[model samples]
Structures are given as structure tokens and as C-alpha cells.
Target chain A: MDKFNVGKHISGKFNEELEAVRNKVLAMGGLVEKQLADALSAIENSDVELAERVLSSDYKINQLELEIDEQCTRIIAKRQPTASDLRLVLAIIKTISDLERIGDEAERLAHVAKASFNKDQEHLLVSLENLGQQVLMMLREVLDAFARMDEEAALQVHQMDTNADRQYEALTRQLMTYMMEDSRSIPKIMDVMWSARSLERIGDRCQNISEYIIYFVRGKDVRHISREAMEDTVRGAKS
Target chain B: MDKFNVGKHISGKFNEELEAVRNKVLAMGGLVEKQLADALSAIENSDVELAERVLSSDYKINQLELEIDEQCTRIIAKRQPTASDLRLVLAIIKTISDLERIGDEAERLAHVAKASFNKDQEHLLVSLENLGQQVLMMLREVLDAFARMDEEAALQVHQMDTNADRQYEALTRQLMTYMMEDSRSIPKIMDVMWSARSLERIGDRCQNISEYIIYFVRGKDVRHISREAMEDTVRGAKS
Candidate 1:
């Protein structure tokens, strides 16, 4: 049996509604993942047109978020979900918020891509692309975890974000050095810095989604808990 | 009859519990407001100790958020609140998320305050402080609106945030000029920029809280709606 189906109801309509909401959330997650990927590629390729497309497409993500929210509210109001079912709806709500924020971060990156920069900072761009790819992967896996209600996969996503943070810090230091070496590069470097920050924030948002998944699956509030403690809690629960 | 008590229940205990949760959220809001103010003062006075205090005290805000969340969950589970009651609890949940994020922005500002900078940059500091004050005022008013369930006050806060954004953009342009004029000032100016960004984010977070208040009171999904449309909706509903 699927972990998400742990609390299956005898009422087929209620189950169908829950599944419908879950599918919508997953669809939103897919759009956000593509948006982030496209935004990063736009930055790497300096494709202003593609960047503009990402920005305009952000409205779709926002619309999906609104739809998902309405669905959750309807579920709560009409179905009156309790216990695990309530947690699932709440998790979906929180997940969509994180996903929408990730979309916002992606839009910020697209704005950076849209800005004109004279010189090509190939090294910095490569690092940023790497970071973006990592976050994108985490987002994909976290959504998968959410689909299956897999706490273990969610924990893996959380761990991956820690590495992404370190990469972001290292990249920031390198960018600061570039700014100091040539003042003329300050504007361009600043854009890169902002894009990097957006990517880092996306990583954090991914961790937020992972936490929500864990909360939904294990019925635990892993937020604000130390990583080690959370790992132990996950392990203890699995055992 | 208090605006918040529009749906007053015959169940005295449920009403008392709801009031208690509301008080907790307000108290948490008060703490967050102080945190933002102290962080700004820390920046203005370059008081590292004060900044450190704000950083350390953020845990309390986070704890309050968790407490309020638990209270909301308990209320939902025990009372099975529907319609306006459900909206109220959901609004509280969303508001605390925004408040906690505001606390986070304050912590980031404090970090900037802790960083050592030689020159006063008095003009920029004053602008940043002015932005902070506006956000703080917005925070205070939004909390008042939440307490009273006032859509009108929330709309006022929403409008103030627009001015805050304009101030932030103007300040950013000024900072960019300063950076271009003196290359060596890049590092210090960047700190100020980050602080300004934090302040702007606080304004956004306040707007989110205001939106939640409006949603709770009006029982309308006002999110993602344009300001003009939202205002028209509010007015149309009122008349």
C-alpha cells in the first residue's frame, strides 16, 4: 500500500477529491521545476527572450497556487477531514506555498538574466548553473517524496540542501573577490550575486517542502529542529 | 459587538480558546514589531550588542509561532470549526508564518548591523531607518486590524506598503550611485543594501498579514488579486 493511501476512506468521493488535490499540487510542482530550470538556462545562455517567458509564465504558477488553495479550503469545509486527512490537506497547503515561493525565486533569477551584462563571467555562471541544477534536483525529489509520502526521500532532499548552502556561500565569496579585483565588474557581479541568492533561497524552499512532506508522513514537526536530531527522529520512526 | 465576535458561539469555552489564541498571535506580533525596530536601531547606532540581542531573541518569536500553530491545530481538531471559524484559524496560521518570516528578515538586518563599517553613510542610514519605521508602523496597524478584524485598516496597511516600496527603490538607486562613485565603498554599501532589502521584505510580509486579515474578515479569497480589484471588491462588499 502507498504511504499516502494509509488513511484511505470508505467514501470513494472523498478519496477521489484528496487525490485530485494531490495531483494538482504535483502539477504545480512540475511547472515550478520547469520554471527554475528554464530560468537557470536563460542565465547561462543569456537568453533574454527565454527569461521574459519565465517571468510571464510565473502568473501561471500563481494561478495554480490559488487553485490548489481553493481546493484545500473546499476539502476542509466540505469533507471536514480529520487526523491524517487533515494533515495531508495542511501539508498540501504548505507545499504549494513553498512551490509558489520557489517560482518567485525563479522569476527573480529570470530578472537577473534579463539585465544586460558586458563581460561573460563564465566561472561564476558555471557555479550558479551547478547550484541551480542541485536545487532543481532537490525539488524534483521532494515532490516525488510528497507523491509517495516518503519521509526518507524527503530527508535526503533536506540533506542535499545543506550542501547547496555551502556552495552558495563559497560562490558569494568568489563573487566578492571578483568585484574587488575590478570595480567595473561590480554591476554584473551584483546581478550574479542576486541570482545566486535566488538559487540559494530556492534550496531553502525545497527544504521547507521536504519538512512538510515529513510532517505529513510521520506526523512530526521537524521545523527548527537540528538536522542531527531530525535525522534521529526519522530513523527512530522508521524503526 | 466586536468585529471579531461576529460569529460568537454559544459554546463559551470555544470562544475563550479562540480569544486566547488571538492574544497569543498579537503578543507574537508585538515581539516581532520590537525585533524589527531594535534591528533598525542597531543599524543606525551601529550597536553590535543590540544586534546580537535581536538575533538571539528570534528563538522566542519562532517558539511563539509554534505555540500558536499548536493552538490552532488543537482548536481545529477539538471544535471542528467551519466557515468563518475555520477561516479565522487558517488566517492565524498564515499570519504567523508571515510574522515569523518578518522575524527572519529582522535577524538578517541585525547581521548587517553586526558587520563593522568605518564611514557613517548617514544619508543612507537615515533612509533605511525611515523605511524600517514605515514597516514597523505598518506592522503595528496590521496587528490592530487583525485584532479587530478590520478590512479597512488592512487596506490602509497595504497602501502604506506601496509607499515603502517606492522608498526602498529610491534608496537602492541612491546606494547604487554611491557604489559607482567610490569603488572601495562597495562592501559597506552592500551591507546597507542588504539591510534595505530586509526592510523591504518586512514590508511585504506585513502586506501578507494584512491580506490575511482581509481574507478572514471578508471571507473572500483576496490573495493574488490586484490592489485595485481587491479594493473594489472590499468596497463593493461593504456597500
Candidate 2:
């Protein structure tokens, strides 16, 4: 998978600026991936210190987003990129927004980890851990797809998200059953439920990032289209 | 209160296109507002029919988002708008995404309305209704601020969202207590809790839209900045 080239613009300076923006976006993506992974580990181990660190580190992700956004704005204002060049900047802007949001969701999960529960409820943590792993994988794959401009890899992320959604739904049902069996566990279970919700949202955001990748690579608005239709379109493009 | 002008590009066709995109976004905002209102009413009254209408109408919001996004992309490609004009289009593109997500949150609330509960549960409904109304007002004001490019109004929305957040936190605590008192009511209470969460998210999205409005009006990225810092910056700009 060859990374999409951005230095094709006539002006060498413009090309250099665009490449800088791309590199910054990838850096930001790396930070968000680390945030998600650390947050998930904090949840699994109930490591309050690590959870606090994840929460504190969200500022860095937010800072990176603002910096990348400013660069995109500057590129558009200075270079006035058109066609594919314009789309590349636009996609980076949108992707960074999603990445920042994923960081926020990770912060939310970290807060859940920071919460104190009376008993060590390993059972409830299992489903959340599973959902977290699935979303983390989706995030990693989508970022890779974005870096390589691989529409096929992006399409695969869409499929992964559907499985994440199923896992989330199952976890919710399981939590509900837990609450019903022992009312005392309701508060602690609710924390896990919120964390699970955040994980599901991260999956949705990852899918959105993949859609942006597809749109950037193929110049197609696959959004609002049915999954089957989107997959078919991707297949058609491949052929 | 003057709307941000976009026709300065020396191309009348570009101005017309920009106006058309703005109109489409406002139309989409109108639909989203209606969805939120209807979903709230359905939740308050347990009106399944109204809830279903809100659910069905979400497709239109999604479609409008896709249309607005495509138009933004086309405008960038054809006009190569610079500086403020470029920022305007980028802001609209981002605003529509937030609008679409608000519609999603409304759809989730509507589903909660559609789910049959054993009892009226008016007690839990009150806080949700309050949060919903606060978010609704914020959404309306933020859209108006965007349409008029009113920095002051957008700032007011930021304040409104703070109140919405407090309401949401209170509601969640109350619902947790309800679940503890009567384990039998846990499932039904969870529905309201989820709906409240959706409202809280809507408030967050509205806040994001307001941030975009500020960005477009002031050409400053207020996002990720602390509220005090953002306010100080806005004041400095005014002075």
C-alpha cells in the first residue's frame, strides 16, 4: 500500500507544507492510538493512576488537533489547493477532528477506570475489555488505511465496526442482567456501561475516519450509503 | 448580527454556490431541531408514533449532511476559496457533521420513547425533559449564531451548555438512586438514563457548533481552549 503522495503541486513550497500537514496528522493519530490503548489497560486493571495519566494526557491530543487544524487552514489560505490536493487537506482536517474525539472518548473510559467500586467485578470488566480491544484494533487499522490511502483496508474497518457494535450490544444486555441480579452492583455496573458506550462511540468515530479515507482516495461520498452499497462501490472501484 | 459574507471571491457563481450551501445547512439544521423537539415530546408523553416519526426523519438529516458535505467539497474544488472564505466552507462542513450527530442522539432518544415501559415514570422524565429543552435551546441559538455569525450569541450558547451538563450529571445520579431503591425498575430507569446521556451528547455537539461559529466569525480556533481563555480572547477581539 503506497502512501498517497501530496507533493504533486506545482509549487515546491506548497508541496512541502502539505506533506508537513500529513506528517502532523499521522503524529496526532499515533498519540490518539496510544491514548486508547492506555485507557483500555487502565480499565482492565482498574489502575487509577494510569487512568489519571490518560485523562491528563488528553490535553496533548487536543493541542495536536488544534495545531493540525491551523496548519490545514493556513495551507488552504496560502496555497489554494484544488482537486485532489484540496480533498487531501479537507480529509486531514476531518480525520483529525475524529481523532481528537476518539481521544475524548478514551478520556471518558479512563474516568470510568478511575471510579472506585466496592467489589472487584471481574465479570463485568470482561465484555468491556473485549469491546475496547475490538475498537482499538479498528482505530489502528483505520489510521493505517488513512496513512496508506488504502480503500480496501478502509473498507475492512467498516466490517470490523459492525462486529464492535454487536459486542457492545451484548455487553449492555449482560450489564442489565447483572444489575437485575444484584441491585447493589448497579452503580458500579453503570460505570462499566458508560465506558462500554464510550468504546462503541470510538468504533463509530473510527468508521467515520475510514469513510473519510475512502472519500479522499476514490473521490466518492460513501457516507449515508448502505453498508452493502458502500462495499459494492468499493469492490467496483477495485475492479 | 450580520451574516458572514462569502461573495468577495470576484466570482458571482462562487458566491451563489456558497449561499446555496449555507441555505442547505440551515435547512438541515431546521430538520434536526424538529427531530429533537419531537423526540423530546415523545419521551415526555411516551408517544410511540411521534417517536417513530423522529426516527424516520433522521434519514433526511443524514441525507442533508451528505449533500452539504458534497457541496462544500465542490465549492473548494471549483472556487479555491482563500482566507475567511475557505474557513467559512470548512466551518460549514464541520457544522453539518455536528448537526448530523445531534440528529443521531435524537434518534436514540426516540427509540427510548418507543420502548414500552411498565409505568409512566414521570419522575425520571422530568430531568430528561429539562436537559432536552436546554439542549434544544442551545441548538437553536447556535444555529442562529452561525447563520448570523453572531459571536455574542455563540458565546451565550457555551454558557447554556454548561447548565445542560450540570442537569445531566444530576439526572444520572438520580437515576442511579432510583435503580438502587427498586431493582425491578432498573431496566426502565436505564432507558431514561440512556436518553439523558443522548441529550448530554447533543449539548456537547451544540457546543462544538458554537465553537465553529466563533472560529468563522473571529478566525480563531477556540476549540480545546479553556472557557476563560476563549472568553478573554473573544473580549480582546471585541475591544
Candidate 3:
């Protein structure tokens, strides 16, 4: 029996509590996903107002994190859950922390979008937007994996970190070229570079979330392992 | 009694287990602290070997994190500890994660040092070096606070984060000036900027560790609260 099973407990109320906590996590993930999307879209279309909206809504994500964090703590203190149940609570704690960090990155991107960029700086913004969209999609898929607790899907998203890294490298190089070509634009270009860095980090955070899903499913800690090793373990494990 | 108490539990063996787990965390923290010091010193002295050493030692910190994580999980599972003991286990889990990330920032700083830089870029390196030292000190003090589980000390260290942020902002402005003055050094300047960012994050992580200490001693979730309020809560508590 999987630890994430819903409504399968001897105590129906306990099942409902677990299920409610899981739902709250999903709801938080959804809000974070939207913030990233809007930040990326705001940068793409240069919508300062939209970016402002994303910034204002970040507190809700933070609030959810605190609330969910307390709930998990209470659950552990009260349930004194064993084995898989303990793992589930621990994973929730780690996942929410990662999600809260993702929200912080989203806020940083929104700040970049809120910064006024003119026509000359549009190319760098375009490159940032492209890399950001890749991260955003990765985040979306990871959340889906999180929702389904699908280890295979989580593995796929984890591998996508390489693509995001390559894109970030390219963007960094391009931003440097622009800075060298016109030193006057150094400040503005730095803003775009910071946004690119945030996107790459968001990609990493998504990878982390994916790994948490893998751990929750496989009862294995895949962090700091080589890809081949993780893949072998994932494929070898019985679902 | 405080949750971080070393020998207060009824079961002497359980007390020993908790103490062992705590010692492991402190050991891990000490390793991360050394990594940061070596990275900063390597930057200041232009010692490539020292930087390489920091990079190689990072894996040890990661290994400790995994080891400590498993031990904490096992403690929770076997002990089914409630109240303070449970909080101690949970706090250990969270603290190790932050310590692991601090090691990552140290790795980034080492890479920046390993990248060769000429004398002309010395000023930017000096600025980064200065900022790196501030973060290093913060890391050290936070770990000490953690060791003692001293709420007052933790609060003191937490307020020092503002100083680190101010230093980071000044360094960022200085780097921007260097980039604009000579576009030829733009790439090198960008590397320094990334190091500065990493140092800033290390500072934030130190603050997080301090908060965890406060939470353990006070039974309060002090995250996301205003500084004034956190101060009031910390000083207002009966600890």
C-alpha cells in the first residue's frame, strides 16, 4: 500500500486529513505555477501591471506555506506516524520549503518584468523569456508529477534540468556579449541576467521537487546521485 | 526543558542517540564553515589549490547531510517521539538541508576563485572577498547559536543578515561600475557578481538556521514575520 493512498485508512477522518493536506499542497503548487507563468508572460509582453499583480499575490503563497507547515507539524506530533506515513510528512515539509523558494524566484522575475526595459534591451529580455518558459513548463510537469505521485514522470522532469542549464548558459553568454558591445547598457542587462539566473534556479528547484516525489514513491533518497544510478534505481524499484 | 537538551530523556540510550544525531549536524556545519573559509581565503590569496580543495570537500558535506537525514528519520520512526523530541528531529531535518545549500554556495565561490583573474580585476575580487567574509562569519555564529540552542544568540545573528545584505548591495554596485568602465572585463565581472549572489544567499541561509533555533527554543513559527515582530516574540517569550 502506498503512503499517499487516499481514503484507505482504518480511520476515515485520518484519511480525510491526509487527503486535505495533499490538496492544500496542490493548491499551493498551482498558485506558484501561476505566478511563474504570469511573470514569464509579463516579461514577454512587457506588462508591468501584470507583473505587479504577480508580486502582490506572492504573500498568499507564503501564507499557505506557513499554514501547511504548521499543519504538518501538528500531524506528526499528534499521529506519531510510522514508516511510510512518516516519510510522507517529511516529504511534505521539504516540498513546501522548495515550493516557497520557487515563489521567491517568481517574485524576483516579476521585479525584472516590473523594471522598465526599452527597445534596445528587448533581445536580452526575449532570450530570458525563452529560458523562463522552459523552466515554467518544467515546473508545470513537476507539479503534475507531484499531483499524480508518478515517479516515471518525475524522472522525466528531473532530466529536463540539463536543457534548462544549457539555455541559461546561452543566455548568460548573450547577455555578456550585449554588455561588451555597449557598456552603457550594463545596468539594464544585469537585471536581465539576474532574471536568467532565477529561471535556472527555478529549474533546479523543480528538479528538487521531482526528486521528492521519487523519494515519496520509491522510499529512496536519490539526491546527489549520478543520473545513471538514479535511473537504474527508479527503473528497478517496484511500483 | 528545551528540545535540544542533550541528556534529559528518560531512556539514556535515546538521549545518547539524540545527542549523536546532533553532533553529526554540528560536524556537518563545521565542514561547511571550513568550505566557506577556504573559498574566501582562496579568493583573497589567489590560491587555486585551496579553491580546488573546497570543491572536492563539498561531497563530504553532501554525504553528511544524507547520513544525518536518515538518522533523523530513523529516530522519528523508532522513537515515535512527541513534543520537544519530535521538534528536534524535524528541526535537524530542516537544518541539514540549509547547511547543504550553504555548502553549495561555497562551491560556487570556489569556482569563481578557480577562474583566473588578472590584477586589474583585483578590486572587484576584494569587494567579493570582503562580502564573502561577512557571510562566513554569519555562518559561524549561526552554527554556534544552533549548538547552544540559544534563542538570544540566534536572534542576534538573525539581525546581522541586514548587514550582509547591505554589503552585497554595495558590492553589486561596485561590480556594475567595473563592468561599465571597461566592457572587456564584463565576463569576469559577471563571475564575481555570481559569487556575490551566492554569498548573499549564504547569508540568508544563515538567517534561516537562526530562525530554526528560535523555533526550537520558543515553539514559535517565526518565519515570514516582520523583524520588529520577531524581535518582540523572541524577547517576549518565557525561555
Candidate 4:
């Protein structure tokens, strides 16, 4: 999408190495996305079996992360690819790290599902599942954006985090009100609040992955920048 | 400390580049450590001014992270460091990312301090500040281990996360009890819970840094490993 071309490398093998590493990252992303979906499913239906599956599946995502990390280090040492190629490698490194952490958050969310909530707390679980679904959608879209290295799509995903945060804040306020109204349910509501917090964090991780995609495509570090500034960087680049 | 001799690189310029990047990371670590200290101080005393300062100081840590990240990327592009040298660069990259997130948690702690707590809620903040100090010590130790790439010390710091987690759980349960006992304090207690969660996360980030130190020295991916396995990796490596 940018000026640098991975396809035109002098060594076709080197191009393959980069492609292979990126593919591994995408594969890891796919597994993590599934884990999030499963975690949300478990939470929604209070499926302890599904939640256990998500927990054990986390080990696989961690394995994929380490495997891909080694491959990236090997490519860097072997190919010594410069410019956008190196940026791509660095972005993959960072993207996988975020993906692994998303898997951790998913595990935590799954734990919330395992907790036996009373009948009165069912509505709180429903609210958490609502937010969980929103975060799941964001994760799916960000992974899609990363797959295409689409700067425009990445920017859109980044902006969507604002809505996710709003949902999370609303849930937190609702949980607090629920606790105040029925103090005996405070312990259960607290667990739901933590789950809501984990969902919010998953949104932030997706936003981080989106930034990495933009960094790879645009050769600019868009992190720590204002939303308007990030938009300008992503939109103003010459294609 | 390991098999690599960074000081004896044939290209003294490359040696300088590597050394310079490592020093920048230490400097950034120093800044983040200070931010954590100030945030804790603000929380203990309810010093809004100091809390604001910690919040502002977060920008500096973020800027330093960006600067150090660019330096690492430039080193890789220019030096093409291989083997241990490349691992050092990678470790530096990953360490700074964790450091930056630690800064974010410190900013979150600062916000907790800025909130006006009721006089009755003071003891909860005291417990939070207790856990805050424990995490602060862990951060300090991890930074020291990272500075030396001391695998032994890193292992020690990594083990400390268990204590931090215990403290966090204890604080969480205590807060829940307080919320149940006095439902009127639910909102304020929830903020304290968030702060305690931040402290626990800071502890995890420190554990990550400790793992990075061991990886830099031992050339192993110790993440997601058992405590015993990580110990074997860190302690069994040849120096």
C-alpha cells in the first residue's frame, strides 16, 4: 500500500521469509480471535465447559506467540531486511505480544463465566456479555485490518475504541449502582465489574494492534498521539 | 554476562550504538520508576498537586519510550546485529514496551489519588498504598536486574509477583467487604479497587521485565513457563 514493495526483493527467498512470518502472526491472530469469541460465548451462556476450553486454548496461543517470536528473530538475523520489511517484522513482534495479552484477558473473562452468579445477577452477566460482544467485533475488525495492512481500516478500528470505552464506563456505573442497591450482591457484582474491565482492556489491545498496522503501512509511530493527529498521519500519507 | 561480549565488537561504532540504546532504556526505566514513586506518594498523602505532576510526568515517559524505540529500530536497520546483539536489541524493545505500560498504570494510580476519598475510606487507601509500595519495590528490583542482565536477580524479582498477587487478592476481598458493610461507600471503594488492580498489573509488568532480563542473558523464551521451568532456564544458563 505504501512506497516500499516487499514483492520486489532481490532474493525471492527473503520475500518468502517475511511473508511466512506475517502469516504466522495472522495465524496467531486467528486463534486469539477464536479464544475471545469462545470466552464471550462462555460468559453469555455461563457455559463452564466452554470457558474451560477457552482457558486451555490459551496455552496454544502462548505457544504460537513464542514460535512466531523465534521465527521473527531468525528472519532478522538471516535476512537483515531493511526499511518497511524491518518495520513489518517489528510490527509483527508487537502485534503478537498484544495478541498474547488479549488471550490472557480472554482467560480472565472466561473465569468470570465459571463463577456461579445467582439469579439476581443474571442481568449483570447479560450486560457484561453485551460489552464482550462489542470488544469481540473490534478484535475481529482489527485482525482483518492487520491482514490487509489497510491504513484506512486500521484508523476506523482505532476510532471505534472510543465507543468501546463508553460502553465499558456505562457498565461500570451500572455495576456500581447495582452494588449500592443490594449490598449483599457486592461480591458478585465486583466479579462482573472486573470482567467488564477486562473487555475494556481487550479493546485497548485491539487499538494497539491497529496502531501497529498503521506503523507498518505508514512508517510512522502513531502511538501516544491525539486522535486527530493520528488521523492526519494515516490519511495524509502518500500512497 | 552471558556468552556474548558486546564490548569487543569489531565495529566500535556498532558497539557504541548498542551501548547507547541500552543506556537510553535504563534512563527511561529511571523515569518510569520515578513516576511510580511520585504516584504512590500522591496516593498516600492525597496530594493533588503531586498526583497532577505524576500524570504530567507520564507524557515524558511515553516520549522516552518512543525515542528509545526509534533508537532500537535504527540500531537494527543500521547495525544488522545478529545473535546475542540482536537479542539485546529485542529485549530492549520489549522492555521499553512494558515500561511504557507501567507508566500508564502509574497514571491510573495518580487519577485514583486525585479522587477525594471520604475520611472513612482512608484505611482502604492505606491498604492500597501498602500494596502500592510492594509493587514499587518489585519494579525497583526488576529495573536493577535488567540493568545488570542479572539472571539470578531477575528470577528473584519474578518470584515476587506471587506476593504482589496475594496482596492484591487480599485487598480486593477487603474492599468487597467494605462495600458490603457500607453500601454508601461503594463508588469510592470501586475506585480503590481499580487502583489496587493497577498495582497488581504493575507487579505483572515487573515480572515481564524480569523475564526479559533472563531472556537477554540466557537466550530463552521464558514467558508462559512454569515457575520451576523458568528457574531452570534462568539458573542453568552458562555465563
Task: Give the candidate number with the greatest DockQ.
Answer: 4
lDDT per residue for candidate 2 within A1-239, as digits (tens), equals: 23445444578888788778888999999999999999999878889999999999999999999998998888887787776777888889999999999999999888888887655576677668788889999999999988888889999998898899999999998898899888888888998999988999999998999898888887888888898888887888566
Model 1 bad stretches (over 4 Å): A119-124, B120-124
Candidate 4 C-alpha lDDT tens digits along B19-64: 7888888899899999999998998999999999998888888898
Q: How far off is model 2, as Cα RMSD? A: 1.7
Query: Global lDDT of each model?
Result: 0.86, 0.86, 0.89, 0.89
Residue B26 C-alpha lDDT in model 2: 90
Tell me the lDDT of candidate 1: 0.86
Residue B58's lDDT within candidate 1 is 98
TM-score of chain A of each: 0.95, 0.96, 0.96, 0.96
Cα lDDT of model 2 by residue, B143-235, tens digit: 888888888888889878879999999899989998888777887898899898899989989889989888887889999888898897667
TM-score per candidate: 0.96, 0.96, 0.97, 0.97
Instruction: Please give the interface root mean square deviation for model 1, in Å.
Output: 1.7
Which has the better lDDT: candidate 1, or candidate 2? 2
Query: Each predicted complex: what DockQ?
Result: 0.54, 0.79, 0.82, 0.89
Sequence-dependent TM-score of model 1? 0.96
Which residue pairs of candidate 1 clash?
none
Candidate number with the higher DockQ (2 or 3): 3
Rank the candidate models, highest lDDT first.
Answer: 4, 3, 2, 1
